[model samples]
Target: MQTVSFLFFNIILPIFIPIIAGYLLQRKFPLNVATLTKIQFYIFIPALLFTTIYQTELNSALLRDLILANLVLFVLLWAVCLICARLMKLDAGKRSAFINSVCFYNSGNYCIPLIQLMYHTPFAFSIQIIVMLIQQLLTNTVGVMNTSSANRSWKGALLENFRMPMTYAVLIALLCRWLSIDVPKPLWTSFELMAQGLVPTALITLGAQLASTHLYLRNFRVLVSNAMRLLVGPLLAAAVCWMWGISGVVAQVMVICAAAPSAVNTVLLAIEYRSDPEFASQTVFLSTLLSALTMPVVIALVQYL
Candidate 1:
Protein backbone atom coordinates (compact mmCIF):
# COMPACT_ATOMS: atom_id res chain seq x y z
CA MET A 1 0.00 0.00 0.00
CA GLN A 2 2.84 2.35 0.80
CA THR A 3 4.53 1.49 -2.46
CA VAL A 4 1.31 2.03 -4.35
CA SER A 5 0.72 5.36 -2.69
CA PHE A 6 4.28 6.46 -3.34
CA LEU A 7 4.08 5.61 -7.00
CA PHE A 8 0.71 7.31 -7.34
CA PHE A 9 1.60 10.58 -5.63
CA ASN A 10 5.18 10.83 -6.80
CA ILE A 11 5.24 9.33 -10.26
CA ILE A 12 1.76 9.21 -11.71
CA LEU A 13 0.02 12.25 -10.28
CA PRO A 14 2.77 14.76 -11.03
CA ILE A 15 3.00 13.64 -14.65
CA PHE A 16 -0.69 13.26 -15.43
CA ILE A 17 -1.95 16.48 -13.84
CA PRO A 18 -0.36 18.61 -16.55
CA ILE A 19 -1.51 16.21 -19.26
CA ILE A 20 -5.06 16.24 -17.93
CA ALA A 21 -4.95 20.01 -17.71
CA GLY A 22 -3.83 20.23 -21.31
CA TYR A 23 -6.56 17.86 -22.40
CA LEU A 24 -9.19 19.91 -20.62
CA LEU A 25 -7.80 23.20 -21.87
CA GLN A 26 -7.89 21.97 -25.43
CA ARG A 27 -11.36 20.58 -25.14
CA LYS A 28 -12.70 23.87 -23.83
CA PHE A 29 -10.76 26.30 -26.03
CA PRO A 30 -10.02 24.20 -29.10
CA LEU A 31 -6.29 24.77 -29.23
CA ASN A 32 -4.36 24.95 -32.49
CA VAL A 33 -2.60 21.67 -32.01
CA ALA A 34 -0.51 22.07 -35.13
CA THR A 35 1.01 25.29 -33.85
CA LEU A 36 1.59 23.77 -30.43
CA THR A 37 3.29 20.75 -31.96
CA LYS A 38 5.38 22.99 -34.17
CA ILE A 39 6.57 24.94 -31.15
CA GLN A 40 7.72 21.69 -29.59
CA PHE A 41 9.18 20.15 -32.74
CA TYR A 42 10.95 23.32 -33.84
CA ILE A 43 11.97 25.05 -30.64
CA PHE A 44 11.45 23.44 -27.26
CA ILE A 45 12.44 19.87 -28.05
CA PRO A 46 15.61 20.95 -29.83
CA ALA A 47 16.60 23.23 -26.97
CA LEU A 48 16.05 20.46 -24.45
CA LEU A 49 18.08 18.00 -26.48
CA PHE A 50 20.90 20.49 -26.99
CA THR A 51 21.22 21.40 -23.33
CA THR A 52 20.97 17.84 -22.07
CA ILE A 53 23.49 16.46 -24.54
CA TYR A 54 25.86 19.38 -24.01
CA GLN A 55 25.79 19.27 -20.22
CA THR A 56 25.90 15.54 -19.55
CA GLU A 57 29.34 14.03 -19.13
CA LEU A 58 28.87 10.65 -20.69
CA ASN A 59 32.01 8.52 -20.88
CA SER A 60 32.84 6.36 -23.89
CA ALA A 61 31.80 3.09 -22.26
CA LEU A 62 28.51 4.36 -20.93
CA LEU A 63 27.68 5.96 -24.27
CA ARG A 64 28.35 2.66 -26.02
CA ASP A 65 26.13 0.80 -23.58
CA LEU A 66 23.28 3.28 -24.00
CA ILE A 67 23.45 3.07 -27.78
CA LEU A 68 23.61 -0.73 -27.84
CA ALA A 69 20.77 -1.20 -25.38
CA ASN A 70 18.43 1.00 -27.40
CA LEU A 71 19.37 -0.54 -30.77
CA VAL A 72 19.06 -4.12 -29.54
CA LEU A 73 15.72 -3.55 -27.96
CA PHE A 74 14.43 -1.78 -31.06
CA VAL A 75 15.45 -4.62 -33.33
CA LEU A 76 14.00 -7.24 -31.05
CA LEU A 77 10.71 -5.40 -30.71
CA TRP A 78 10.48 -4.81 -34.44
CA ALA A 79 10.94 -8.53 -35.12
CA VAL A 80 8.37 -9.48 -32.53
CA CYS A 81 5.84 -7.03 -33.96
CA LEU A 82 6.35 -8.37 -37.44
CA ILE A 83 5.77 -11.93 -36.32
CA CYS A 84 2.60 -10.95 -34.50
CA ALA A 85 1.28 -9.06 -37.51
CA ARG A 86 1.95 -12.04 -39.74
CA LEU A 87 0.14 -14.40 -37.39
CA MET A 88 -2.86 -12.10 -37.35
CA LYS A 89 -2.88 -12.07 -41.17
CA LEU A 90 -2.96 -8.33 -41.32
CA ASP A 91 -2.64 -6.58 -44.67
CA ALA A 92 0.25 -4.27 -45.50
CA GLY A 93 -1.34 -1.12 -44.11
CA LYS A 94 -2.39 -2.75 -40.86
CA ARG A 95 0.94 -4.50 -40.58
CA SER A 96 2.83 -1.24 -40.85
CA ALA A 97 0.70 0.42 -38.19
CA PHE A 98 0.97 -2.61 -35.94
CA ILE A 99 4.74 -2.70 -36.19
CA ASN A 100 5.08 1.03 -35.56
CA SER A 101 2.65 0.98 -32.63
CA VAL A 102 4.60 -1.74 -30.90
CA CYS A 103 8.09 -0.47 -31.68
CA PHE A 104 7.97 3.34 -31.50
CA TYR A 105 7.14 4.85 -28.12
CA ASN A 106 6.53 8.25 -26.54
CA SER A 107 10.01 9.03 -25.31
CA GLY A 108 9.64 12.80 -25.29
CA ASN A 109 6.58 14.45 -23.80
CA TYR A 110 5.55 11.52 -21.63
CA CYS A 111 8.97 10.25 -20.65
CA ILE A 112 11.07 13.38 -20.08
CA PRO A 113 8.74 14.71 -17.42
CA LEU A 114 8.26 11.34 -15.83
CA ILE A 115 12.00 10.81 -15.42
CA GLN A 116 12.56 14.36 -14.19
CA LEU A 117 9.85 13.88 -11.58
CA MET A 118 11.11 10.50 -10.44
CA TYR A 119 14.89 10.97 -10.36
CA HIS A 120 15.42 14.75 -10.19
CA THR A 121 18.94 14.27 -11.47
CA PRO A 122 20.73 15.10 -14.68
CA PHE A 123 22.15 11.61 -15.03
CA ALA A 124 18.78 9.93 -15.22
CA PHE A 125 17.34 12.66 -17.41
CA SER A 126 20.35 12.39 -19.70
CA ILE A 127 19.65 8.71 -20.17
CA GLN A 128 16.13 9.53 -21.24
CA ILE A 129 17.48 12.16 -23.65
CA ILE A 130 19.72 9.61 -25.33
CA VAL A 131 16.80 7.27 -25.67
CA MET A 132 14.74 10.09 -27.15
CA LEU A 133 17.46 10.94 -29.63
CA ILE A 134 17.73 7.40 -30.89
CA GLN A 135 13.97 7.11 -31.04
CA GLN A 136 13.50 10.28 -33.09
CA LEU A 137 16.23 9.31 -35.49
CA LEU A 138 14.75 5.88 -36.08
CA THR A 139 11.16 7.07 -36.15
CA ASN A 140 11.96 9.54 -38.85
CA THR A 141 13.93 7.19 -41.02
CA VAL A 142 12.69 3.64 -40.63
CA GLY A 143 9.25 4.71 -39.56
CA VAL A 144 8.86 6.94 -42.60
CA MET A 145 9.96 4.24 -44.98
CA ASN A 146 7.61 1.77 -43.38
CA THR A 147 4.64 4.08 -43.59
CA SER A 148 5.18 5.44 -47.08
CA SER A 149 3.31 3.88 -49.99
CA ALA A 150 5.00 3.21 -53.33
CA ASN A 151 6.68 6.12 -55.11
CA ARG A 152 8.01 7.40 -51.76
CA SER A 153 11.72 6.82 -51.63
CA TRP A 154 14.19 6.21 -48.82
CA LYS A 155 16.00 9.35 -49.90
CA GLY A 156 12.91 11.37 -49.14
CA ALA A 157 12.71 9.82 -45.68
CA LEU A 158 16.36 10.59 -45.01
CA LEU A 159 15.79 14.14 -46.14
CA GLU A 160 12.83 14.42 -43.82
CA ASN A 161 15.03 13.36 -40.92
CA PHE A 162 17.65 15.89 -41.90
CA ARG A 163 15.00 18.58 -41.94
CA MET A 164 14.17 17.93 -38.30
CA PRO A 165 15.75 20.50 -35.97
CA MET A 166 16.21 17.89 -33.26
CA THR A 167 18.82 16.19 -35.43
CA TYR A 168 20.80 19.40 -35.81
CA ALA A 169 20.47 20.28 -32.14
CA VAL A 170 22.13 17.02 -31.19
CA LEU A 171 24.80 17.43 -33.81
CA ILE A 172 25.59 21.01 -32.79
CA ALA A 173 25.72 20.07 -29.12
CA LEU A 174 28.18 17.29 -29.86
CA LEU A 175 30.27 19.67 -31.95
CA CYS A 176 30.34 22.21 -29.13
CA ARG A 177 31.37 19.52 -26.67
CA TRP A 178 34.14 18.14 -28.89
CA LEU A 179 35.50 21.58 -29.65
CA SER A 180 35.39 22.68 -26.02
CA ILE A 181 33.42 25.73 -27.06
CA ASP A 182 31.39 27.57 -24.51
CA VAL A 183 27.90 28.79 -25.23
CA PRO A 184 28.03 32.48 -24.35
CA LYS A 185 26.26 33.26 -21.09
CA PRO A 186 23.67 35.32 -22.92
CA LEU A 187 22.89 32.50 -25.35
CA TRP A 188 23.10 29.80 -22.67
CA THR A 189 20.47 31.59 -20.57
CA SER A 190 17.97 31.52 -23.45
CA PHE A 191 18.73 27.85 -24.02
CA GLU A 192 18.29 27.02 -20.34
CA LEU A 193 14.96 28.80 -20.16
CA MET A 194 13.68 26.90 -23.16
CA ALA A 195 14.92 23.62 -21.72
CA GLN A 196 13.10 24.28 -18.45
CA GLY A 197 9.84 24.92 -20.26
CA LEU A 198 10.10 21.81 -22.43
CA VAL A 199 8.46 19.44 -19.97
CA PRO A 200 5.27 21.36 -19.30
CA THR A 201 4.85 22.61 -22.84
CA ALA A 202 5.42 19.15 -24.24
CA LEU A 203 3.02 17.48 -21.84
CA ILE A 204 0.38 20.08 -22.53
CA THR A 205 0.80 19.76 -26.26
CA LEU A 206 0.43 16.01 -25.91
CA GLY A 207 -2.74 16.57 -23.94
CA ALA A 208 -4.09 18.88 -26.61
CA GLN A 209 -3.31 16.30 -29.26
CA LEU A 210 -5.06 13.66 -27.23
CA ALA A 211 -8.07 15.89 -26.88
CA SER A 212 -8.52 15.98 -30.64
CA THR A 213 -7.90 12.30 -31.30
CA HIS A 214 -10.82 9.93 -31.92
CA LEU A 215 -10.66 6.48 -30.38
CA TYR A 216 -12.58 3.24 -31.02
CA LEU A 217 -11.44 0.56 -28.61
CA ARG A 218 -13.49 -2.35 -29.89
CA ASN A 219 -10.89 -3.55 -32.37
CA PHE A 220 -8.94 -6.61 -31.31
CA ARG A 221 -5.88 -5.24 -33.12
CA VAL A 222 -5.87 -2.19 -30.89
CA LEU A 223 -5.89 -4.38 -27.80
CA VAL A 224 -3.05 -6.47 -29.18
CA SER A 225 -0.99 -3.40 -29.95
CA ASN A 226 -1.51 -2.02 -26.45
CA ALA A 227 -0.54 -5.30 -24.87
CA MET A 228 2.66 -5.36 -26.88
CA ARG A 229 3.40 -1.76 -26.03
CA LEU A 230 2.44 -1.73 -22.34
CA LEU A 231 3.35 -5.26 -21.33
CA VAL A 232 5.81 -6.81 -23.72
CA GLY A 233 7.83 -3.63 -24.12
CA PRO A 234 9.10 -3.38 -20.55
CA LEU A 235 9.63 -7.09 -20.27
CA LEU A 236 11.83 -6.91 -23.35
CA ALA A 237 13.64 -3.90 -21.92
CA ALA A 238 14.35 -5.71 -18.66
CA ALA A 239 15.66 -8.74 -20.49
CA VAL A 240 17.90 -6.58 -22.67
CA CYS A 241 19.27 -4.78 -19.64
CA TRP A 242 19.99 -8.07 -17.93
CA MET A 243 21.68 -9.42 -21.04
CA TRP A 244 23.82 -6.31 -21.20
CA GLY A 245 24.50 -6.43 -17.44
CA ILE A 246 22.96 -2.96 -17.02
CA SER A 247 21.65 -2.08 -13.56
CA GLY A 248 20.91 0.92 -11.39
CA VAL A 249 19.34 4.04 -12.80
CA VAL A 250 20.32 3.22 -16.37
CA ALA A 251 18.37 0.00 -16.29
CA GLN A 252 15.53 1.64 -14.44
CA VAL A 253 15.25 4.42 -16.99
CA MET A 254 15.45 1.88 -19.80
CA VAL A 255 12.53 -0.07 -18.38
CA ILE A 256 10.41 3.00 -17.81
CA CYS A 257 11.06 4.40 -21.26
CA ALA A 258 10.31 1.09 -22.88
CA ALA A 259 6.93 1.09 -21.22
CA ALA A 260 6.02 4.55 -22.51
CA PRO A 261 2.91 4.55 -24.74
CA SER A 262 3.03 4.76 -28.51
CA ALA A 263 4.51 7.93 -29.98
CA VAL A 264 2.00 10.54 -31.16
CA ASN A 265 4.08 11.10 -34.28
CA THR A 266 3.00 7.69 -35.50
CA VAL A 267 -0.46 9.07 -35.99
CA LEU A 268 0.85 11.92 -38.08
CA LEU A 269 2.84 9.54 -40.22
CA ALA A 270 -0.19 7.33 -40.66
CA ILE A 271 -2.30 10.28 -41.75
CA GLU A 272 0.36 11.45 -44.16
CA TYR A 273 0.91 8.12 -45.85
CA ARG A 274 -2.67 6.90 -45.62
CA SER A 275 -1.43 3.77 -43.89
CA ASP A 276 -4.34 2.94 -41.66
CA PRO A 277 -4.51 6.26 -39.81
CA GLU A 278 -7.44 5.05 -37.75
CA PHE A 279 -5.46 2.16 -36.37
CA ALA A 280 -2.49 4.37 -35.64
CA SER A 281 -4.59 6.92 -33.79
CA GLN A 282 -6.49 4.27 -31.90
CA THR A 283 -3.30 2.54 -30.77
CA VAL A 284 -1.82 5.83 -29.67
CA PHE A 285 -4.88 6.79 -27.63
CA LEU A 286 -5.62 3.46 -26.03
CA SER A 287 -2.00 2.70 -25.26
CA THR A 288 -1.51 6.11 -23.63
CA LEU A 289 -4.66 5.78 -21.51
CA LEU A 290 -3.69 2.28 -20.48
CA SER A 291 -0.13 3.31 -19.71
CA ALA A 292 -1.53 5.47 -16.90
CA LEU A 293 -2.16 2.17 -15.10
CA THR A 294 0.87 0.19 -16.32
CA MET A 295 3.63 2.82 -16.03
CA PRO A 296 3.50 3.16 -12.26
CA VAL A 297 3.70 -0.57 -11.80
CA VAL A 298 6.67 -0.70 -14.14
CA ILE A 299 8.33 2.19 -12.29
CA ALA A 300 7.78 0.54 -8.91
CA LEU A 301 9.20 -2.76 -10.07
CA VAL A 302 12.22 -1.12 -11.64
CA GLN A 303 12.86 0.87 -8.47
CA TYR A 304 13.15 -2.34 -6.47
CA LEU A 305 14.77 -4.48 -9.15
Candidate 2:
Protein backbone atom coordinates (compact mmCIF):
# COMPACT_ATOMS: atom_id res chain seq x y z
CA MET A 1 0.00 0.00 0.00
CA GLN A 2 2.79 2.36 0.85
CA THR A 3 4.49 1.42 -2.36
CA VAL A 4 1.32 2.18 -4.27
CA SER A 5 0.97 5.56 -2.61
CA PHE A 6 4.61 6.32 -3.13
CA LEU A 7 4.29 5.42 -6.77
CA PHE A 8 1.34 7.73 -7.09
CA PHE A 9 2.69 10.74 -5.26
CA ASN A 10 6.25 10.45 -6.42
CA ILE A 11 5.89 8.94 -9.86
CA ILE A 12 2.39 9.22 -11.25
CA LEU A 13 1.05 12.44 -9.78
CA PRO A 14 4.11 14.50 -10.60
CA ILE A 15 3.77 13.51 -14.24
CA PHE A 16 0.00 13.71 -14.67
CA ILE A 17 -0.59 16.90 -12.67
CA PRO A 18 1.57 18.90 -15.05
CA ILE A 19 -0.13 17.32 -18.02
CA ILE A 20 -3.58 18.11 -16.68
CA ALA A 21 -2.64 21.59 -15.59
CA GLY A 22 -0.92 22.37 -18.84
CA TYR A 23 -3.86 21.12 -20.81
CA LEU A 24 -6.18 23.37 -18.82
CA LEU A 25 -3.92 26.39 -19.28
CA GLN A 26 -3.60 25.61 -22.95
CA ARG A 27 -7.34 25.56 -23.30
CA LYS A 28 -7.29 29.16 -22.07
CA PHE A 29 -3.98 30.54 -23.32
CA PRO A 30 -3.39 28.32 -26.35
CA LEU A 31 0.38 28.43 -26.16
CA ASN A 32 2.49 27.19 -29.03
CA VAL A 33 3.34 23.66 -27.98
CA ALA A 34 5.57 23.27 -30.99
CA THR A 35 7.92 25.97 -29.78
CA LEU A 36 8.22 24.37 -26.34
CA THR A 37 8.85 21.00 -27.93
CA LYS A 38 11.59 22.45 -30.05
CA ILE A 39 13.26 23.95 -26.99
CA GLN A 40 13.21 20.59 -25.24
CA PHE A 41 14.45 18.71 -28.25
CA TYR A 42 17.27 21.06 -29.15
CA ILE A 43 18.53 22.28 -25.80
CA PHE A 44 17.20 20.64 -22.66
CA ILE A 45 17.28 17.00 -23.71
CA PRO A 46 20.81 17.25 -25.00
CA ALA A 47 21.98 18.91 -21.85
CA LEU A 48 20.42 16.17 -19.76
CA LEU A 49 22.03 13.50 -21.88
CA PHE A 50 25.53 14.96 -21.87
CA THR A 51 25.60 15.58 -18.16
CA THR A 52 24.17 12.20 -17.17
CA ILE A 53 26.56 10.24 -19.37
CA TYR A 54 29.61 12.39 -18.69
CA GLN A 55 29.45 12.02 -14.92
CA THR A 56 28.42 8.36 -14.72
CA GLU A 57 30.77 5.43 -14.29
CA LEU A 58 30.40 3.21 -17.33
CA ASN A 59 31.33 -0.42 -17.80
CA SER A 60 30.84 -3.14 -20.43
CA ALA A 61 28.18 -5.10 -18.55
CA LEU A 62 25.94 -2.09 -18.14
CA LEU A 63 26.32 -1.17 -21.80
CA ARG A 64 25.54 -4.71 -22.91
CA ASP A 65 22.42 -4.92 -20.75
CA LEU A 66 21.11 -1.56 -21.85
CA ILE A 67 21.69 -2.38 -25.53
CA LEU A 68 20.14 -5.84 -25.24
CA ALA A 69 17.10 -4.52 -23.38
CA ASN A 70 16.48 -1.87 -26.01
CA LEU A 71 16.93 -4.36 -28.87
CA VAL A 72 14.48 -6.78 -27.34
CA LEU A 73 11.88 -4.09 -26.77
CA PHE A 74 12.34 -2.64 -30.25
CA VAL A 75 11.92 -6.00 -31.99
CA LEU A 76 8.84 -6.83 -29.96
CA LEU A 77 7.30 -3.44 -30.66
CA TRP A 78 8.09 -3.72 -34.37
CA ALA A 79 6.34 -7.06 -34.54
CA VAL A 80 3.35 -5.66 -32.68
CA CYS A 81 3.14 -2.68 -35.04
CA LEU A 82 3.27 -4.86 -38.15
CA ILE A 83 0.60 -7.18 -36.85
CA CYS A 84 -1.60 -4.29 -35.74
CA ALA A 85 -1.19 -2.55 -39.09
CA ARG A 86 -2.28 -5.59 -41.09
CA LEU A 87 -5.18 -6.39 -38.78
CA MET A 88 -6.49 -2.85 -38.83
CA LYS A 89 -6.24 -2.68 -42.64
CA LEU A 90 -4.87 0.80 -42.33
CA ASP A 91 -3.83 3.06 -45.21
CA ALA A 92 -0.24 4.21 -45.51
CA GLY A 93 -0.54 7.35 -43.42
CA LYS A 94 -2.70 5.81 -40.72
CA ARG A 95 -0.45 2.78 -40.80
CA SER A 96 2.56 4.95 -40.14
CA ALA A 97 0.88 6.55 -37.12
CA PHE A 98 -0.24 3.16 -35.91
CA ILE A 99 3.22 1.72 -36.30
CA ASN A 100 4.76 4.67 -34.49
CA SER A 101 2.13 4.62 -31.78
CA VAL A 102 3.11 1.08 -30.94
CA CYS A 103 6.83 1.42 -31.48
CA PHE A 104 7.69 4.66 -29.64
CA TYR A 105 7.49 4.88 -25.86
CA ASN A 106 8.04 8.06 -23.80
CA SER A 107 11.28 6.86 -22.35
CA GLY A 108 13.42 9.94 -22.01
CA ASN A 109 10.98 12.52 -20.73
CA TYR A 110 8.58 10.43 -18.67
CA CYS A 111 10.61 7.47 -17.49
CA ILE A 112 13.55 9.42 -16.14
CA PRO A 113 11.63 11.09 -13.34
CA LEU A 114 9.86 7.92 -12.31
CA ILE A 115 13.09 5.94 -12.20
CA GLN A 116 14.76 8.55 -10.04
CA LEU A 117 11.80 8.70 -7.69
CA MET A 118 11.48 4.95 -7.30
CA TYR A 119 15.06 3.73 -7.17
CA HIS A 120 16.95 6.78 -5.86
CA THR A 121 20.24 5.42 -7.10
CA PRO A 122 22.67 6.95 -9.55
CA PHE A 123 23.33 3.52 -11.08
CA ALA A 124 19.65 2.95 -11.66
CA PHE A 125 19.32 6.42 -13.16
CA SER A 126 22.33 5.69 -15.34
CA ILE A 127 20.72 2.53 -16.65
CA GLN A 128 17.55 4.42 -17.51
CA ILE A 129 19.64 7.07 -19.27
CA ILE A 130 21.45 4.47 -21.33
CA VAL A 131 18.21 2.73 -22.22
CA MET A 132 16.66 6.06 -23.24
CA LEU A 133 19.66 6.87 -25.41
CA ILE A 134 19.23 3.64 -27.30
CA GLN A 135 15.53 4.31 -27.58
CA GLN A 136 16.13 7.83 -28.88
CA LEU A 137 18.54 6.60 -31.55
CA LEU A 138 16.28 3.82 -32.72
CA THR A 139 13.22 6.06 -32.77
CA ASN A 140 15.04 8.71 -34.79
CA THR A 141 16.52 6.30 -37.32
CA VAL A 142 14.52 3.12 -37.86
CA GLY A 143 11.35 4.56 -36.43
CA VAL A 144 11.53 7.50 -38.82
CA MET A 145 12.02 5.18 -41.74
CA ASN A 146 9.11 2.94 -40.75
CA THR A 147 6.73 5.88 -40.53
CA SER A 148 8.12 7.91 -43.41
CA SER A 149 7.29 7.92 -47.09
CA ALA A 150 9.33 5.65 -49.34
CA ASN A 151 10.81 8.72 -50.98
CA ARG A 152 12.55 9.50 -47.71
CA SER A 153 16.14 8.46 -48.16
CA TRP A 154 18.14 6.50 -45.60
CA LYS A 155 20.90 9.06 -45.96
CA GLY A 156 18.62 11.84 -44.80
CA ALA A 157 17.51 9.79 -41.82
CA LEU A 158 21.12 8.97 -40.97
CA LEU A 159 22.01 12.62 -41.09
CA GLU A 160 19.17 13.54 -38.77
CA ASN A 161 20.34 10.85 -36.38
CA PHE A 162 23.85 12.22 -36.44
CA ARG A 163 22.58 15.72 -35.72
CA MET A 164 20.83 14.71 -32.50
CA PRO A 165 22.42 16.39 -29.44
CA MET A 166 22.00 13.27 -27.36
CA THR A 167 23.92 11.34 -29.99
CA TYR A 168 26.85 13.72 -29.78
CA ALA A 169 26.76 13.59 -26.00
CA VAL A 170 26.81 9.80 -26.06
CA LEU A 171 29.75 9.85 -28.45
CA ILE A 172 31.68 12.15 -26.15
CA ALA A 173 30.87 9.97 -23.17
CA LEU A 174 32.04 6.90 -25.05
CA LEU A 175 35.27 8.64 -25.98
CA CYS A 176 35.83 9.71 -22.40
CA ARG A 177 35.27 6.17 -21.24
CA TRP A 178 37.66 4.79 -23.82
CA LEU A 179 40.31 7.35 -22.95
CA SER A 180 39.83 7.19 -19.14
CA ILE A 181 39.27 10.94 -19.03
CA ASP A 182 37.56 12.66 -16.12
CA VAL A 183 34.93 15.26 -16.79
CA PRO A 184 36.00 18.58 -15.27
CA LYS A 185 34.04 19.78 -12.21
CA PRO A 186 32.90 23.15 -13.58
CA LEU A 187 31.57 21.57 -16.76
CA TRP A 188 29.86 18.85 -14.74
CA THR A 189 28.09 21.48 -12.63
CA SER A 190 26.92 23.32 -15.72
CA PHE A 191 25.66 20.12 -17.26
CA GLU A 192 23.90 19.20 -14.04
CA LEU A 193 22.09 22.54 -13.87
CA MET A 194 20.97 22.23 -17.48
CA ALA A 195 19.95 18.62 -16.97
CA GLN A 196 17.75 19.62 -14.02
CA GLY A 197 15.47 21.56 -16.33
CA LEU A 198 14.70 18.52 -18.46
CA VAL A 199 12.03 16.71 -16.47
CA PRO A 200 9.62 19.47 -15.36
CA THR A 201 9.91 21.40 -18.58
CA ALA A 202 9.37 18.26 -20.56
CA LEU A 203 6.32 17.25 -18.55
CA ILE A 204 4.82 20.70 -18.79
CA THR A 205 5.50 20.80 -22.49
CA LEU A 206 3.87 17.41 -22.89
CA GLY A 207 0.89 18.77 -21.01
CA ALA A 208 0.78 21.79 -23.27
CA GLN A 209 0.88 19.56 -26.31
CA LEU A 210 -1.91 17.46 -24.88
CA ALA A 211 -3.89 20.60 -24.25
CA SER A 212 -3.36 21.68 -27.82
CA THR A 213 -4.56 18.36 -29.21
CA HIS A 214 -8.17 17.74 -30.11
CA LEU A 215 -9.54 14.87 -28.11
CA TYR A 216 -11.72 12.80 -30.40
CA LEU A 217 -13.29 10.49 -27.89
CA ARG A 218 -15.89 9.43 -30.42
CA ASN A 219 -13.20 8.22 -32.76
CA PHE A 220 -13.34 4.57 -31.77
CA ARG A 221 -10.65 3.54 -34.22
CA VAL A 222 -8.22 6.01 -32.78
CA LEU A 223 -9.12 4.91 -29.27
CA VAL A 224 -8.58 1.26 -30.07
CA SER A 225 -5.27 1.98 -31.75
CA ASN A 226 -4.20 3.89 -28.66
CA ALA A 227 -5.37 1.06 -26.44
CA MET A 228 -3.04 -1.29 -28.21
CA ARG A 229 -0.25 1.19 -27.67
CA LEU A 230 -0.89 1.63 -23.94
CA LEU A 231 -2.14 -1.82 -22.98
CA VAL A 232 -0.84 -4.53 -25.27
CA GLY A 233 2.48 -2.82 -25.88
CA PRO A 234 3.60 -2.98 -22.25
CA LEU A 235 2.42 -6.55 -21.83
CA LEU A 236 4.53 -7.56 -24.80
CA ALA A 237 7.51 -5.73 -23.31
CA ALA A 238 7.08 -7.47 -19.95
CA ALA A 239 7.05 -10.85 -21.68
CA VAL A 240 10.28 -10.01 -23.45
CA CYS A 241 11.91 -8.97 -20.18
CA TRP A 242 10.83 -12.22 -18.58
CA MET A 243 12.21 -14.24 -21.43
CA TRP A 244 15.48 -12.43 -21.20
CA GLY A 245 15.68 -13.27 -17.46
CA ILE A 246 15.68 -9.61 -16.52
CA SER A 247 14.87 -9.21 -12.83
CA GLY A 248 15.12 -6.77 -9.92
CA VAL A 249 15.56 -3.03 -10.44
CA VAL A 250 16.78 -3.45 -13.99
CA ALA A 251 13.73 -5.47 -14.90
CA GLN A 252 11.50 -2.95 -13.19
CA VAL A 253 13.08 -0.10 -15.13
CA MET A 254 12.63 -1.95 -18.41
CA VAL A 255 8.99 -2.67 -17.67
CA ILE A 256 8.21 0.88 -16.56
CA CYS A 257 10.01 2.46 -19.48
CA ALA A 258 8.22 0.07 -21.79
CA ALA A 259 4.93 1.06 -20.18
CA ALA A 260 5.22 4.73 -21.23
CA PRO A 261 2.78 5.92 -23.85
CA SER A 262 3.60 6.80 -27.45
CA ALA A 263 6.24 9.49 -27.53
CA VAL A 264 5.48 13.03 -28.71
CA ASN A 265 8.22 12.38 -31.23
CA THR A 266 5.73 10.16 -33.04
CA VAL A 267 3.52 13.18 -33.62
CA LEU A 268 6.49 15.26 -34.79
CA LEU A 269 7.53 12.52 -37.19
CA ALA A 270 3.98 12.12 -38.41
CA ILE A 271 3.80 15.82 -39.20
CA GLU A 272 7.23 15.82 -40.84
CA TYR A 273 6.55 12.73 -42.95
CA ARG A 274 3.06 13.84 -43.93
CA SER A 275 1.45 11.02 -42.10
CA ASP A 276 -1.81 11.44 -40.13
CA PRO A 277 -0.53 13.92 -37.63
CA GLU A 278 -3.95 14.55 -36.18
CA PHE A 279 -4.44 10.91 -35.45
CA ALA A 280 -0.88 10.63 -34.24
CA SER A 281 -1.23 13.58 -31.89
CA GLN A 282 -4.61 12.49 -30.64
CA THR A 283 -3.42 8.98 -30.01
CA VAL A 284 -0.34 10.16 -28.15
CA PHE A 285 -2.35 12.55 -25.98
CA LEU A 286 -4.98 10.00 -25.06
CA SER A 287 -2.50 7.22 -24.41
CA THR A 288 -0.49 9.45 -22.11
CA LEU A 289 -3.62 10.42 -20.21
CA LEU A 290 -4.62 6.79 -19.82
CA SER A 291 -1.12 5.74 -18.81
CA ALA A 292 -1.67 7.25 -15.36
CA LEU A 293 -3.80 4.23 -14.63
CA THR A 294 -1.97 1.75 -16.81
CA MET A 295 1.61 2.40 -15.66
CA PRO A 296 1.04 1.83 -11.95
CA VAL A 297 -1.00 -1.29 -12.68
CA VAL A 298 1.71 -2.57 -14.98
CA ILE A 299 4.35 -1.90 -12.35
CA ALA A 300 2.33 -3.66 -9.65
CA LEU A 301 1.74 -6.66 -11.83
CA VAL A 302 5.41 -6.92 -12.70
CA GLN A 303 6.30 -6.71 -9.03
CA TYR A 304 4.03 -9.61 -8.23
CA LEU A 305 5.09 -11.69 -11.18
Best by TM-score: 1
**Tens digit per residue, CA lDDT, model 1, 203-291:** 88888888888888789999999999999999999999999999999999999999999999899889888899989989998898898
TM-score of structure candidate 1: 0.95
Whole-model lDDT values for every prediction: 0.89, 0.77
- Measured with C-alpha atoms, the lDDT of residue 124 in candidate 2 is 73
Instruction: Judging by lDDT against the true structure, name the best candidate.
Output: 1
Off by over 4 Å in 1: none
Please list the Cα RMSD from the true structure of every candidate, rounded to 1 decimal place. 1.6, 2.2
Please give each candidate's TM-score.
0.95, 0.90
Q: What does candidate 2's lDDT look like per residue over 12-98, in tens digits?
A: 997788777777888888888778777777777777777666667767875786688679878877787777778878887788788
Clashing pairs in 1: none
